[model samples]
Structures are given as structure tokens and as C-alpha cells.
Target: SVTGNRVAHTANIDRIAARGATFHRHFTPNQICSPSRATMATGLYPRHHGLWRNGVALDGRLPNLWQALSLAGYATKGVGKLHFQPLLAPVERDMPESLAYWERPGCEDWHGPYFGFDAVDLVMGEANEATRAGHYAAWLKRNHPEVVDLYEPDANPDSRAQDLNEVWKSAVPPELHYTS
Candidate 1:
């Protein structure tokens, strides 16, 4: 974890922690991203938030921290992988966080107000090429089309041969990485 005492190569994360706050005794409502993030936003357990698992959407009607902050006259913005909704659900569901919505006709114009955020700049998933879908992808396509194709899994054929099946080095250069 980024907050681990002996963790290395997390200077940026550490700086943020220093500037604000870090939890020493953290308790999570769910193990996964969506449910956990929802818990943080709504200050409610998964059952109360109506998002018990990954693919389920959080009920928009529920009061959340972002909305509360907005109502309190703060501008709320989200960046990167919010994961508040399914990244691969059907497009008809109107899940703006999903790749389906990001691939639509005018998705490039979408910046947010989504799920109580006044504005958002989203990236749907991790650095994996297959899941590269959102504003970041659009920016990459527009500005670095030459290397975008290299992000595909097959671009680095040896990536899948690692001892840990889920571990693979991406062919996308560090300079072009989502976190870059």
C-alpha cells in the first residue's frame, strides 16, 4: 500500500499524505474498489449504498460526500479511476463511468457532473491496454496515436510468460503511461 511505512517509490503519494491526512487505523466496508469508494463517498456500508459488488451502480439518490461538499460551496472534482460504476456494463444503462459510455458518438465532450461530481477527468481502469477507456484514452489518441497501438497485449508477446499470471509489463512506454 502507498501508506506503508517502508514503501519505496511513492514520493508523490507520501507528499500528499503529509500535506493532508493519512489513516493509521483504516476500516473498509468492502474489499473491492467500487464498493469501497462508494462507502467513502456516502459514509455508508455497501448494503446501505446499494452497491454490494463490482458491477452494481451506487444509487444516485443517496447523499454522498461530494454532494455534501458541493452543497457546502466547495467545487468537487474527480480524477483518474473513480470506479464508481461498472467499467464494462451495457451502454443503455447510462453509466458514464463505463467504457461503453466513453465510446459513444460524442464522448469526447464528457467531463462530468457525474455521480455528484461537479467535474471529472476519468480513466476507467488500471494501466492495462484493454481497459484504457475514457478522457485519458481520448487524449492519448489525439496526442500520441503512434504509440497507442503498442499498448495492446500482443504488442509485447513475452508479457504473458511471467511466473505470476496476472503480472505483465506493458509495452506502452513510461512516458505515455496513464499515470504519467
Candidate 2:
């Protein structure tokens, strides 16, 4: 495909390709987001990991790359998006609505064996680019209040939880955008 790609000519991928062989195909066990993440993290097929759908996620019960490394005495830290749990569901009926893995208030306090990560700055809400409000949100709150409203516009402390808007674009500055 790079044969016809104008931008590809400017990319250093050419150097990499010259040093190696180029192939167009790749493999994955599943197409769903959390399941695919779990597969890579846990090194298990979707069925084996017991997270075959979007609303479910792997918990402490599973063995993952982080856990293996941590067990061997590595000091682990995860920043940015790490979807170790399901965003749509509660952890347990008795437990309070599950704490987010991303930049949740107390999330930074818990030094866990969480999905093998000793510490995490998690970002959930992969459903919509506009929906993420985790550590990144906290960062904005601390460093730049003006940009905070753009990402979590309805996250008014005065208001109770509002339903998130689905599949939409935010006109927030590109400098403030996660993709940028």
C-alpha cells in the first residue's frame, strides 16, 4: 500500500522496511477492545481470559504481564490508558461503584497488585474520544482549568452524574486533545 502512499515516502518506515521485509497481514484473537487488551496483557485467548464482551473485564484473579514481572520484584508503573477493568459494570454488588483504573481521585493512592501493575494512571472511556475523564482529567484540573471543560464539559461538581454524549467530536484545542 505504501507504493501509492504520498506520506509514506516521508516516513522513516522506508528505512525500517529496507532493513527488514514488509508484510501487509497481521493477526489478532478478537476484534473487541477490552478483550483484545486483555489478550495482550494476560497472554490468553479471549475465552480463556473470560472477557469475551465489552462490558466485562479482567480482575485481580487473572495472571498478567504486570503480575509476573511484579512477582519478581519489579517496581511497576503504568501511565495513560490501561483498560484493566470494565467501565460499564460494577466490580461487585456489595462494593461501591467500581473505582476507575485511570486518574480517579483515590486511584493514585492505591499501590496495588492491580492487574499486576503496582501503580497506575488509568484512562477509561474508550467508547468515545469525548468521554475520557481520568488521570488526564486530574492533570488538567491541576495544571489547566480552561481545557478541563472541553473534555468533561458536563463534569460539573454541582451536578450529579450526567449521561455521557456518544460518538461526538469536541472542538477543544488540538494541543489539549489526547490524539495530538
**Model number with the top lDDT:** 1
**Tens-place lDDT digits, model 1, residues 56-170:** 8888998989998999999999887888888778989988888788768988797879777899988877755434678888888889887788766567776655422454556
| Model 2 C-alpha lDDT per residue in residues 21-102, reported as the tens digit of each score | 8777987798977789889988999889988877675765888888888899999987656665655554342111134334
**TM-score of every prediction relative to native:** 0.79, 0.63
Q: What's the count of clashing pairs in each model shown? A: 0, 3
Residue pairs that clash (backbone atoms under 3 angstroms), model 2:
67-116, 102-122, 103-135
**Global lDDT scores for all candidate models:** 0.78, 0.59
Best-matching candidate per TM-score: 1
Please state the error at residue 135 of candidate 1 in Å.
Answer: 0.5
Model 2 worst lDDT run, 10 consecutive residues: 93-102
Q: After superposition, how far is residue 173 of candidate 1 from its true place, in Å?
A: 4.0
- At residue 149, candidate 2 shows an lDDT of 62
Tell me the lDDT of model 2 at 105: 46
